[model samples]
Structure formats: structure tokens, C-alpha cells
Target: MSRSLSIIWLFGLISGFNIMITGNTLNYWLAKENIALQTIGLLSLITLPYSINFLFAPIFDSLRIKYLDKIFGHRLSWICLTSIALVFFVYILSFLNPFDNLLLFASISLIISFFSSMQDTILSAFRTEIVNKESLGFASGIYIFGYRFGMLIANSGAIYLSIYLTFNEIYKIFAILIFVYLILLIVGVKYFNSFNVIEEKTYSSHTSSSHLHLSLYHSNTSLCHSRTSLCHSRGGGNPVNNINFIKRYYNHLGKSLSSYILKIFLDSRLRGNDIGKSENDLSLLSFIVLILIFLILYRLPDNFINVMINPFLLHLNYDAFEIASVGKFWGVMGAIVGGLIGGFIMKKKNILDSILLFGIIHALAHILFIILKIYGKNSTLLFITIGAESITGGMTMTAYIAFISSLCQGKFRATQYSFFSSMMGISRSIFPIISGYIVVNFGWQNFFLFTTIITIPSLLVLLKIKNKLQQ
Candidate 1:
């Protein structure tokens, strides 16, 4: 990856750490003000906006202002807008005591949360779109490394600060980091601008509206369902009839599909372009679908249990420091080690193989969490299990993110990667919402066992697309 790209991916530092900020700062501030525990329970709902950011992702893709693009560049304009909003609103939060007016505080918190989430969503796509293919593994490693580091910084620093600093003082310091984020962002833009990212040319033809300004070259392409081939008939030829539908359909049906629906996405990745083979791109339709599937199912089992980890630890009567030692402190160290290892491995092998190997490891590591249920009372065993699982999970996730970066194309990466990453957020919310009932009905042992099973289909999916990805 270019230095610019690598620096840009560091936004994961802020994104990953935001979780710690929200959970810690909110709790500390509320307790200081003597707010009801019940009010705190309601405040947790402010985070819901993060889960559903995807519903609004399409707006970024479809809407554009020519004037803004001229000044800040295409994606940068939106990034700047959201970052400004995030800083402004978060700084505002440092002033209001939720104890004084819970509703308004919650509303402002939600607004800040929305901007933070949007910043993450936009950055995920921006990083994917601009990053070089040869650097996908390296870039992903940098991201994972930075993100894990950020987690440690947030958890360790914020928690420590609460002992000395007031809630407003602590938050103001966090708000200042956004300015640092903006500075790093500007530096990245400077480096990125040195290269030719988007190539524009003038033409007599107009799209949508007439102006001296012409948009980036985009043309209508089709899924070509019947043919199962991405035929480039841009600007002139028909999507449906240009290809020999009979021949295409027969050829498509000739292959034995492991899963027709899933395989289509892979097939398109092997063939799509701007109506032609430019950089050997995948069709937007296929890229979107592949990301969606991977996002929703790839780590569904992990996320399902991840949401309940704190409660599980608490149920076992572990202290916050103990949890932090195993999870945040040592966990970050493990993740950093894993990310570097994953990067080196990806250098030696194809991204697909790296993904396949680590993906399985990630799934199998869940068994360690189940072991926690059985040995619920042993801190020594807890230390070992949590350490082992956290390390393995970190290794696998770095590789998994490399896989996600590989799927994104620069053309509509903002929309596509946002959609993919958004589904990941949504699944965290969806599975956890029902998790209480699952644990109550089945008990922790059975619930964890089912979590292991939910992972199987994702592995099966990886198997189905193996050949297509090899293309």
C-alpha cells in the first residue's frame, strides 16, 4: 500500500476505540451525576444508529455535487463533512450533563454516535476503493494493528483518566483526537492527490443534466441472469439480447453449482469492468452481493457470542480489571501479533487461501468460549482460554479483513464497502437482540454450541466459491 493508503486505514484506530469511549465515558459520567441505572439502560439504545448505517449508504453513492467534488475530491468532501459534524457534536456532549436532561443528552449522544458511525462507514469504503491490490494484505494488517492499538489506548487511557479527570475533561481530550484524525486525514489526502486516482475526460454527450462539467465515466451494465456472462455492450448494445441467451444459459447450467446464488457473485468478480476488462474488475452487482454474504455470515457465530462476553464474564464474577487484562490489554497485544503474522502469511500465499485458513481457525476458536462455560469458576483456566481464543480470533480477523478489502473495486467502493461493513454491524445487533432468549431457553452451553454450528454455512460458502476466486 502507498503510505497515504496505509495512513488512511489508521482511521480504524478511532473507529475501534470509539466502542471503549462510549461504554466507559457514558457510564462514568452518568454515575458521577447520580443518574438512575434505568436511565443508563435506556442510553444504551443510542448506539442503534451504528447498526443500521447501511440503510443510508446508498445516498452517498447516488448523490453528488460537482462543486464539492472540485474542491475536496469525490469522497473527501463527505469525509470532511462528517468529521466536522462528529467533532462539533462530541464537543457539545462534553458540556451537557445527562442527569440534568436525559432526553436531550441522549439525543445529542445519538447524533455524535451517528456521525462517528458514518465516519467509519465512509472510511471503510474509501480505504477499500483507493488501496492498491498488491497491498491489500499489508493494508489490512496495518488497519488491524492500528485498530487493536486504538482499543488498548482507549480502554487503558480512558479508564485510567476517570480516576483523575472529570467526565467533561476526559471527553474533551477524546474530542481533540478527532482533530488529530482530521490532520492525519489531510496528510493522507495530500499523498493520495500526488497520484492519479480518477481520470476524467470531456465529451459532447450529457448525462442527467448539461454543464461544462462531466461526471466520471459510468455506463449501464446488467446482471445478465440468463446468460451468466458479463457481456460488455456499453452505450450501444443491449444487456439482455446482445449475448446468445440460449448458449449462455446452457453453459451456465452446465456447471454444477454448489450454490447458484452465491457463486454468481464470484463469477462476476472474475469478469466485470467499466463495460470492459479494466484492471480485471468485478461487476458492481457481483461485488455488492459477495460483500453482503461475507459480511452477514462469515463471522455471524463470533459476533453472536461477542455481544454477551461482558455479561458472561460478569456472570462468572470476574472483575473489570481482570476482564481488561485478558480481553483489552493482552487481547490487543495478541491481535497486533496476529495481524503481523497474517500479513506475512498473505505475502506467501493467495488472499483466498489466507482467508480460508484463518476463517476456519476463527470458527474453531469459539470452542474455547464454550470451555469457559464449563470451567466458569477457574480464573487460571479463564486466563488461558481467553488468551488463546483472543489470539486466534485476532489472527483470523486480520486475514478476514484482507479478504474483504480484496473484494472492493475503486469504482463504487464507497457504496459497496459501506454496504458490506454495514451488514456486519447489523448482524451484531440482530443476533444479540435475541441472545437473551437463546441463553434463557437453551442455557449457555447449548447456546454456545449453536454458535459453533452457525459458522458451518460460512465455511461451506467459502468452499462453494473456491474455484471462482481462483479465477
Candidate 2:
């Protein structure tokens, strides 16, 4: 692989591994410790930062970290700092006993998640900014390959290692590995810089009107219409003047409220921030909201299944090594294969089509879990089910990365990508809170069925925006 490709792959691997340790890997450990299912479900809350990191994504895009920026550049500086901090916390997390000091354990886990989210936010922006348009697909495929590989090690490898090592020991070993990557990041700063093609641009106050402006305008117009009708109902004199006054008053109020909300979650300079720009700008804001909603819904099945899978496997009487070997190792192999398939399909098809195809397959893959439930600890069936699920999961995830990367604008690349990604994280971080309860109450088969059915909404949303995405 080329140097740039290698860096992209390594960052993806590190990020994928880091995210999993706090998620599925940790869930497995908790299950093994005999923790209550509800409590384990609540653990997803610790990752809240992942879902909301967009609130601060603009800072990474527009602000500079003093000395670190001088040495590592704006994006890399944040990446390095967050990596170091995440590794440090992971190492410390290893020393805590969840049974005795649950609060401390949870607190440290939250901190680890915060830094991990920060690292991921900046790294995604860096990845998006570094590669040119022509190479993005190949680069995205490589990164997904690396990411799945890292998740494989974290999920299956960590479990397999637990045969001879304590969870504490495993965490420390992983921390050391992450720290090694950090050292390489510092050493290779110049190499990465060589591939940095994006120029630093000054922020401008002028807003570009597009679809977002249309959405804002429509939003205000709707409000004014509602108020204008209320004025007519009052049967006041000078009806035309009253209607005009209501429109003016409500439009200003709506714009002020919309602007405040945008300033909080988006860069003030977004194309639709200023009201009355153009119909296109309103449409742009509405499109952004639509995309964000689509992103949140797209991965629902996968996220719902993830939190319970390891625990479910253990309940099937599969040993840690067996589960790790099949679920983690071969599963990752399947994902890598799926990534290749996704890339090939992308070359032949539009991105939305690829996403829809993979999404259908992704939802269908959950049915294998139902079959596994019926088979009852049959190792061969377990292998087949996990391999199939991982393949579909990989394809859908790769398409998702490509879809979002295509949407990022240059100057706001980091903030916009982060917003999209953070919305995606909502599925990963929040929806799983109910996963454990569902399994506990409805049983695994029903839980799997529910997950499969829930995927319909995302597909429906995808279809609703099909023309917009195609355009």
C-alpha cells in the first residue's frame, strides 16, 4: 500500500478498535461478570458524547490549539491530543473494579468515550480533507477494511485472550498498543503533512443560499400562515394590515429562533443561517435535516443487535474462544470481503442504490440470529450466521461512509461531517439502551425479529429522499 493509504488504514483501525472496546467488548465483560441486563443496557449512556460531539465540531474546524497546532497542524493536533488522553484513560480504566466502585468505573468509561469521540471527529475530518475526490472511494474501502480488522481484534481477539488473561490485563495490553500508534503518529507527522492537500481558508460572514434557505423560509412562512389565520379568526378591523403585521412579527421571531438553534449546533456561517436569503438556502437546510434523519435511522438494525450479540452467544454455551474465533475473527474476514464487494458495486452503481441494496441485505442478515436461536449452540450454524451478518454489516457500513463523505462541503467539511457522523452515532450510542431489555423480556428470537422489522423505517426514509440523494 502507499504511505497515504497506510496512514488512512491505521487511523481507521485504531478508531474502530477504540470504539469497540468501550461498546461491545465492554458489554461482553459485563455480561460475564453477571451484571444485570438493564444495567448493561444503561451503559450505552456513557457514550452520549459520541452522539453529541457535533456540538463542538466547529471548534475543530475553525479554532486552533496553540502549541499543538504549530507542530501537528490543526486537525492532527486534536487527533494526537485526544489519542493520548483516550489511551491514558483506557489504561486507568483497567485498574477499576466495576463491582465495587461502579461509579468510578462508569465515570472513567465516560471520559474514555469523550476522548475517543473527539479523536474520531477530528480523524474523520482529516481523512475527508486529506484525500482528493478521485481516490476517495478506494481510500474509504481501505479504511473500512482496517476498521473492521481492528474491531475484530477488539471483539474476538480480546475475548480469546481472556482465556489466559484478565480483562484488566487485556485492557492494559490494548492501551499499550494504542500508545504505540500515538508514538508513530508523532513520528510520522511530516509524512502525513505531505499528503495534506486542503488549504486553510478564512471564515466568511456571507451566507450562501441554497436548499437550507428554502427550508428556513418555508418554516417561517408556515408559522406566519398559522398566525395569520389566528388573526382572521379574531375578526379584527383592517384585516389586510393585521395579516401583514402577523407575517412580519412571526417571520422575525422564527428567524431569530432558527438562527439561535443553528448557532448552537452548526457554524454561524452555514448557507442557510441568515433568513430570507433564497428558496434554495431554505431547501438546503431542509435537505440537511432530512439527511441527518436518514443517517440516524439507517443503522438501526445493526446497533440494536450489537449490544446483545455477545451476551446472547455466551448464553448459547459457546466458550469465549469459540465466540471470539467465529464472531470476531471470521466475522471480520466476512466484513473485509463485504467491503470489497461494496466497492465493486459502488463502481458499477450509484451511491444511493448501493446503500439501499446493502441496507436490505443488512436487515435480512438479522434473520440468521433467529435461526441461531433455533439451532441452539450448533457451532457450524453460529459460524454461518455471524459470517453472513458481518458481510452484510460491512457492506452497509461502507456505503454509509461513502454516502456521508460525498456530502461534506470543503470549508465546513469537519463540522458538517461531524454533524452527519454524530447523527449516525445516535444509533450506535442511544438506541441500544433498550436492547438488553428487549432480549430479557421478549427473548432472543423476538428481539431479532423486532430488529429486522425496525429497519423498514430507514428504508422508507431512504426511498423518500431517493431523488434528492440521486441529484
Using lDDT as the measure, the top candidate is: 2
lDDT score for residue 252 of model 2: 39
lDDT of each model, Cα atoms only? Answer: 0.58, 0.70
Local distance difference test, candidate 1: 0.58
Residue 437 local lDDT, model 2: 89
Clashes of 2: 19
Clashes of each: 0, 19
What TM-score, over all chains together, does every model reach? 0.60, 0.73
> Over the full model, what C-alpha lDDT does candidate 2 score relative to the true structure?
0.70
For residues 13-96, could you state the per-residue lDDT of candidate 2 as single tens digits? 888888887877888888887777777877888878878865545445445567986676666778778877878899998998
TM-score, candidate 2, is 0.73
Candidate 2, residue 414: Cα displacement in angstroms equals: 6.0
lDDT tens digits, residue span 236-261, model 1:
12223323433443465456433333
True-structure RMSD, every candidate: 10.8, 11.9
